[model samples]
Structure formats: structure tokens, C-alpha cells
Target: KTIFPPEGRHWSILEEKFLALVAEGKVFFGKNGESQPGLIRYLSEVEGLVPWTWWPHEEVGHTDESKKEIQQLFGKSAAFDTPKPERLIKRVLEIATNPGDLVLDSFAGSGTTGAVAHKMGRRWIMVELGDHARTLVAPRLQGVIDNEDRGGVTEATAWKGGGGYRYFRLAPSLLEYDKWGREVVSKAYNSAMLAEALCKLEGFTYAPSETEYWNHGHSTEHDYLYVTTQTLTHEQLRDLSEQVGEGRTLLVMCAAYRGDARSLPNLTVKKIPDHVRDRCEWGRDDYSLEISALPMAAEPKPDDVDLFGAPAK
Candidate 1:
């Protein structure tokens, strides 16, 4: 509200407004950097919930409860020795994150973190290297998704689980080094796998056609990819070119091909391993950042000095 004369000025609030404020409990600091007569407003504030340092098992959960949780999901045979309580995980998640935030538990023992995160409406990634990942962790997460298991913070968070998660298994590296240190596709990869891998590398979706042998994948309607371990002859290329027809192109990856491959208009022929060798890391396994692997920095010259006049070391 605007006041005509807000002259009873204090440092910021006008004195007249301040006195009027004191008289009617209405005068307060106004926009003119002073309290003015009949000019008043108030601001309200809300205190947020304070985070506590201590979490008691009585409130979150204890080991016995966690064991029972595992037992309920998969029976005693699959229970982890060091499984964490779901409520414990829930408490931590509630404090640290909000709905739809991602939670990563790299050491996912019994998948308590994932289950709690999911129930709390958060996305999660759980990694377990042990075999229990399949036997214990996966089954536990499945229970969380199905809504059948409501033991932990499920009821507290009001989560009726329905979302699903993806699972992946790590396979051995696809490339290996031959006797002469030449990079080649691993023998472990069959023709189908090789084709799929090459398709992915070439940015094509791998969808093998049932009717057409040459159709391993396609980048577009007119562009197709064919992968093979067989050595193609000139006649085979001629046949493939004919089948591919006009307004269509084919990328042919073969072990080796006889005769001039460029003569075919529709086919772009490439040699396996030779065309692909540089694209992948071959044969080596250890990728750890070892101290010895790093190039040592030369010791600073004893005569060198920094800008601050400190001796270099």
C-alpha cells in the first residue's frame, strides 16, 4: 500500500510508518527504504527438515531383518552373508536423492540399493561381479519390480512396483592378435556373431533377413550389409550384384575375394580383418592404470627455479 508521506524515517524504515506500524501493528518497512504511515507488509519463512548424522538400526533395519528379506525372496540357500537392510538403503536414498535421480551401486551385494532406489522412484544401476548377481541380485530386483515383495521401504515409500530393468552379461573381447601380432576377429566369434558385431561397428542395426542370405543388416532401405568368412569368387560377386539390382547398394565383407572386385557396380567389397584391424584393440587384456605403464616425469633440474623463486624439484 502506498503512503503519502513516509517521513518518520529510520535507517531503512520510515519513522511515521514505524510508529503507525507500532500503533496498529500494520506499519512496516516500505519500498522507499523506510517505514511509512499505514504502509506495511510481512514476509513468512519455513524451516526445512534437518538432516541427522546418526541412523539407528531400530528405525532403518538390522542384519536379521535383511537376512529374512533375502530368505523371503530366494530362501536361505541364496541369502548373502553381508546383505544390507532395504530400509537402511532407503534412508540413505531419501536423504541423498529425489525421484527420477540415478543411483549407481557398483558393488551391488544383494541388490538392496537397487531395490530401495526403485521403490523410491529413482533409476538405478547395480553391478555385481559374483555369480550371486544371477542367483540373488537379479531375483531380488525382480521382486521389487513385480510388487509382490513389500517387506522393506515399499510400504513407507508407497511404491507399487511395475517398472522393468535391463540385464547384460559381459563377454570376452571380440578381437585377438594372431602369431605375427596381426589383429583378427576372435575364433570364438562365429559368422552370425561376426556379422552382428560388424553391423554394429558400421552403425547399422543387425536384423538378418530369413529369405535373403546376403541381407545381414541395413542402414537404409537401399543400403544393405553382408558379412561372411567365405572367400568369394568373381562369379559369386556377379551373382550378388545381380541379386542386389538397381537403386540398391551392398557392402560385402569377406575373408578374401578372387578377381577384380571393383568391376561390380552395386557391390562395395571389403576384406575382413584387413579392413577392420585398426578399428579394434587386439589380444591385450590388462587395462589397469599401473604405475609402471606411465611414462616417468624427468626430475626437475636442480638449477631450475619457478617464477616465485622456489627451487624446482
Candidate 2:
């Protein structure tokens, strides 16, 4: 509108849409309970439409259709043994979830879940450790963006293709040892990981500054948090405070600190181990239920005992 405004800077398609929505009795606050643009309920009324679970392949697509979809998206070479038809996924979404709900596919095979979710206007997270994550999923998603591959629920959903996605290469899960001893954590929380965790814990955004050493995250523009494994001395804290200066406040989480931490109002100092310990269950590896030892069952006396070690009937 900024580039192609017919009525100079006074025209807005949003205003027209709002008026049209008002006439249609659909304009209201967004799902987040805010009367904001973009999020505001527009023409989409099929959000939580519950479809039946007993869907036949005739209604949705069958395994043949799934293979056809793969061929259309990728190629004949991308023949999956049990490919999920897009219509099947659509029905699943209709039955289980509402639009805008998050869908997680742990093993994204041919990235069917993600593709369907994208078309159906649902947020999705696809975790794929295999080679196809890059070769198949990436290309498929790019096709979704370019509005090329129009098989499956594409026609049903009328997907115009305008959303963006982020791709992350996660570190492989490995056993990690802490300073105390060899302990098993699912994934070792490094310094950055610790900082990110602490930031979320303290209700701050995990945004590390490139230039500044102290700024790890921030709740507000002026308020920041710094996480470290080293024990901070009073002198160090003083230097930090000086660096931070007035107006801005910093939350410093470390292993240990000497002298009074409450001396500086700007720097809120906290110990890492105790607080972090409270956040998680660590140290012990064994997580099984402990079976208590029972005393040996007393032998029955001759007077009470029967033929089969029971009282006579």
C-alpha cells in the first residue's frame, strides 16, 4: 500500500477489510484477546472445526495418493513405504487441533506434518535428524513458499503461501559431566544454555549482545541479566556496577560471591548452583522406584499348619 497507494498516503486496505468484517459480523479481538491487526479474526471461521476420526481413504486420500503427492512434490525416486496423504493429515488436524495451535512432528518423514500444518494455517515444529530433513523437508517447505506443489490439501485450504520459517541445526544429544562429578544431563547446558535458561527463569529475553560482555539478556531495555560460573568478588561487582552506570539494572548470577551482595542496588546478585539445583533434579543417575526389603515370612507352627502349609479346613 505504501508503494502503490492510489489515494496518496491516505488509503489503507486494512480499513476496508475492517469495515467488511464489521458488516459480516466477524470482526472481533484476536485469539490472544487483543484488538490488534493481523491477529484479528478475519474471514477464517473454520478454526476449531471437529471432523470425524473414522475417515475412509475415499474421503481423504489413500496410500496411493500419498505416493502421488510425494511424486508431485519431490519425484518418483522419493517413494516412501508409508507416506501420509495431505488430506489425511488435514482430517487429523481437524479432529485433534484448532488453527494456530502448535503441531510437533518428532520424526518428520518427507515433512508431511509440517507441510499440512503450513497450508492449514497452524504453527508447526518438525524435528528430523535424518538426511531427508535437509534434502526433502527444506525443499518441500520452499515449494510451499513459492506456491508450486499444489497437491493434497492445497486446493481445499486455498493456501496463498506467505509465511516464513526458521531452520535450526541442533547439537547432537550427548552425556555431560559437571564440575561436581560425572552426571548425566540429556543435553549439557553450556554457558550460553545456562544464560538462556536463566534469562527465561528471570522473565528476560535471551538476547546476547555482541559488544558488551555483561549483557546476556533483558527484561526491559534498561534491565539486563548476566550469568557466569566464576565467583564474583565485591571489587568485580563494583567494576560491573560502574560499567552498567545509572538508570540500568543488572541481574548477575554466578557460582559464588564474596562480601555483601546487597551493597549495590543496581546489581542483583544470586548464586547459580542452589537456584539451578532447585530448578532441576540432578546428581543421582538411578531414577527407578526403590523396592524396600521385606522381612522373611514367619514359618507356620505345627498346630496351625495344614497338609499344604495352610490351616485345616
Candidate 3:
């Protein structure tokens, strides 16, 4: 199986391995002893059906066609250089996923993955750092939801979109450092906001009990989280420990505590600055590059400016 005559050398690694496979009847050498056989049976064909590994021009699609699809939807020249064809995305989704599967695209360019997933009845999370996330992505998704978007596999899939998706912007950090490099709770957070933040941080649901001031939220039925900006004394800790009851454990997040909080078995007191200092990259909440800044509208020419209500001149 060597490219050169076997008289000089044994087969190369590829040829040696292939010849070995032939010996094991896994690959077929031609009946007439052809040098390189056409057939390599890696696996038994499923009902003699083979999926096309190579795509024709139509299946994979070209750049021009992709641009056309974009133009049909957006009704203008696309801002992107190479937006993927909807057909290509649909094909990939068909092969790689099933209905109701969750798809995540971190680099969602023109929101094609999300659009395709939506049409295909898949849940998707699309994250884009550019202005397109607000302008392009959000609008495209809204169109899909309203069944107003006609382009990109819509007709082929019989997609009459009727689904819901929630959009959320990342909240700013809850803790930051000051000029003295001392960590403190963010001034942006109020008492209620601080409580909700602490609930999330401590792995508890943000469900404040109406009957109990200390019961901000719960990790379990008996384990509760309480967040306060006030510094606590030993007397306050003792009182809280006693009030927490026999079976309950109270995790109190405060600005400061005077006594050894671990002394009480039922009470676990964590100081705010110390507890959440290393939890996140403090004060560095907005990580997005925001690739495209908002475009300013072109200023109107003197002649083009409206002057219907102007005084006679």
C-alpha cells in the first residue's frame, strides 16, 4: 500500500493501518486488485443509507444567498460581512439537536442561531456584546415571536411563531472598593436590594416572609437568611439566636458583629464586607465590549429642515 513500490519500503502509517483494516475484512480492496479501493466500510450502513458528508452548492449555501436572506428580513444591506444562511443553520440544528433542546450561542452575531432554534422549537440563549443585541437581535426575535418575519426557513418549516422569551440586562455589582481600598456594599443598593442580593449569594430564594423580619429568605424550611446594613452587638446576636427557635438556623449578614458569631450554634453571622469581598470581581459588572456604539442620526441639511411653522421671512 506504499505510494512507492513495496520493494524499497513497507507501507507508511496510513497505508499500514488501512492494509491492516483490509486484512480484517473491514475495508475492501477491489475485486480486480485495484491499487486504491473506492470502498471503506467504517460501519455497517444503516439500511444501506448513508448521510451525505459532502454538500452540493445548494445545501451548504453561498455568501450571496446568505446576504439575500438577510436583505429579505432586514430590508437593507446587512451590517455583517458573512451572515450564515438559514438553511445551513437549520441543517445543523436538525443533525445536532432535537425539539425542545436548549441551545446556547455565546457569540450570537446576527442572532441566526437563536432565530433558527426558535423556528425549530428549541429553547435558546443568545449572548451578543454589540449594539446588535439591542437593535438587530432583539428586533429579529420580536419579529419571530409575532410571526412577522417571513425569511430564513420560515415558510419551509411552516413556522407560525407563538412563544415567549425573557430579556434581561446584567445587574451591576453589589460590592466595591473605595479610595482607601476598603470593600463596602455598593451605594446603589438599598436595604431591600441588599437583602435580595444576599439571598441570591447564599443560595436561597428571594422570598421575604411577611410575618418575620429576620426571615428574608430560606435555604430550607428551617434555615433562613437575613441581611442588614446595621452593625450588631453581642446582645442582638444572643436575642436573635434565642428568637430563631429550637430547630431553626439563622444566617445573618450584617455590616459588623461585636461577638464571636460561631459561639451560638443556631446563629451564623457573616459580616458583609468580608463575606462578599472575594465573591465577584467587585465593581467590574459591565464586561461587554459593546462593539458598536449607538449610531447618531445624520443632521438635516438647512434646506431639508422643517420650517412650516416659521415666521414669514
Candidate 4:
């Protein structure tokens, strides 16, 4: 993923997009100016695997050597101007995906995704629209499969064996206007798709609820969490609070509130705008900003310097 500056220095546009993506459970950002623009790639299909904050390259083991190797390999090529580092992709693959799992990279670029996938014993499918797809993406991936050491992965130990991949180009969007020019919705993903996407975005494991009134989902720790887009009355809060597990924190996100959130014990009622705004801020400004200029002292000579000054006196 790459971070580009706001389109026209329009912070509002960027904020709106950021908030919308966050609400949809996409990506997160740190405090203003402390974050870079990038996409969070999902390497596995696990709930709560998506991070709630941006992780720096240093934090993810992206070393200077690895970065230099990647730049040398694909930086000269005009075909892939924004190629991601293989080490970065490898880390994501290690965390989210397993061996033999299918990995897809629609914007294949320099084929880092495919190369990493091949080395990690996973199958990959890549899509590239440009003419250099063959010259650039293909050769990079071939180097990985054939274990060519163009970038630094030696043939002897890097990819001692071979792997396979299939390339394809998909339409812009599944939805297209008919001859009559009317709107059309594709059946690519129905309710199940929406639920799965929601689950992925919201860091929840999707499950059907026994009761009709409550939606069912759990975190990675198997803690029961209920989310509703409706207001909770006092009776509803009391009843729901009773259903909360012992020694567990009951977090509830609601649209409107009628009763006081402090009334419910062991329950953390999070109001949308207030909670999000409170948690997310531009900067903390905790550090000191004062600066001073002082003259540097010259080193003293052993003979010229006084030896405890009092002995001479």
C-alpha cells in the first residue's frame, strides 16, 4: 500500500473519505501527520485480524536491505512505478494466509504478491491491464518461479522448486447498464456477502442468532458482542446488561440514547460520533516545543586548566 497526499490539500475531503472507510470497517489511521496513506491488505480470512491502527515498516520488520533490494529490482521499470516490497507482502502472507491458500492481486504491478505467494507455497492469481503486464509482471513472477536472483532471492535456497499462476483481466465493475439504460445489480454477493464483508470490516465473526431481536457475532476471543443501529431504552439496556457475561466488558454501539449510559454496570455504551471523535484526534501536542541556542564550550587543556584551582591558590 502507498500513501499519497490529499488531492488538493482538502483536509475535509480526506477526512470524509477516511471516516467513511472507517465506518465501513476498512482501514484506520493514526493522529494527523503521523500516518501515511496506504491500504491494508488481508492475507488471511480470520476475524479481528485487521488492525485498528496503522503499522510502520519498522514495526513490521521491513529492513533497509530488503527495501533496497526491492527498489533495485523494479524501480528502474516504468511499468511498475508503485511496486510494493516483497518482504512487506511476505509478512502479510505469513500472518493472514496459510499454505496452499489462494491469493489474488488485481493490481499486480511488479508481481511482488505473486512472487511471495509462490515462495510461501500458496497459489496466486494476478491481473494487470497495461501492455507491460507481460514484460514486467510476467518476468518478475517468472524470476520467482524459476528462482532467479535478480532481486536477491537466490535460486539455490530461495525458491528451489517451481510454482504456477494464472493471469486474468476483469471488467471494470460487474454492474452495467442494460440496452434501456436502467440500473442493474449483479448477484455477485447477496445477503451472505454483505454479512461476511460486514463481519470482516467490523472485526466480528458472523453467526446466526437464536433470538430475532439481537444480531450475533463474536470476537477472536469468543466474547459475545452485540451491535445495533437502533436506540436502547432503559428496559432494553437492563435486560441486555443482564445477558452480559461475567468478567466481560459489554460494548454497545447505538444510534440514539434515551437513558444514561452510566446506569448500566459493566456495560460500556459507546455513542457513535462522541466516542469516535473523542478517540480520534489530529494531534496530542503533549511534547514541549520550546527551543534554545547555546554557545559550545571549548575543550580544556590539561596544563592550562586549573587542577582543582584551590591547590594553586
State the C-alpha lDDT per candidate: 0.81, 0.77, 0.79, 0.58
Per-residue lDDT of candidate 2, residues 48-113 (tens digit): 434565778888889999998898877898776678999989988877778999999988989999
Model 2 spans with C-alpha error above 4 angstroms: 1-54, 95-107, 129-131, 169-175, 178-201, 206-212, 280-313
lDDT of 4 by residue, 6-28 (tens): 44432223457666656775553
Every model's TM-score: 0.66, 0.60, 0.69, 0.34
Q: How accurate is candidate 4 locally (lDDT)?
A: 0.58
Query: Model 3 lDDT vs. the true structure?
Result: 0.79
Model 3 pairs in collision = none
> How well is each residue in 31-113 modelled by candidate 1, as lDDT tens digits?
67464334333333222355788888898889999999888888888768988888888888878898999999989998989
Winning candidate number (lDDT): 1
Top TM-score model: 3
* Candidate 3: clashing residue pairs, number: 0
Q: What TM-score should be assigned to candidate 1? A: 0.66
Worst-scoring 10-residue span by lDDT in model 4: 304-313
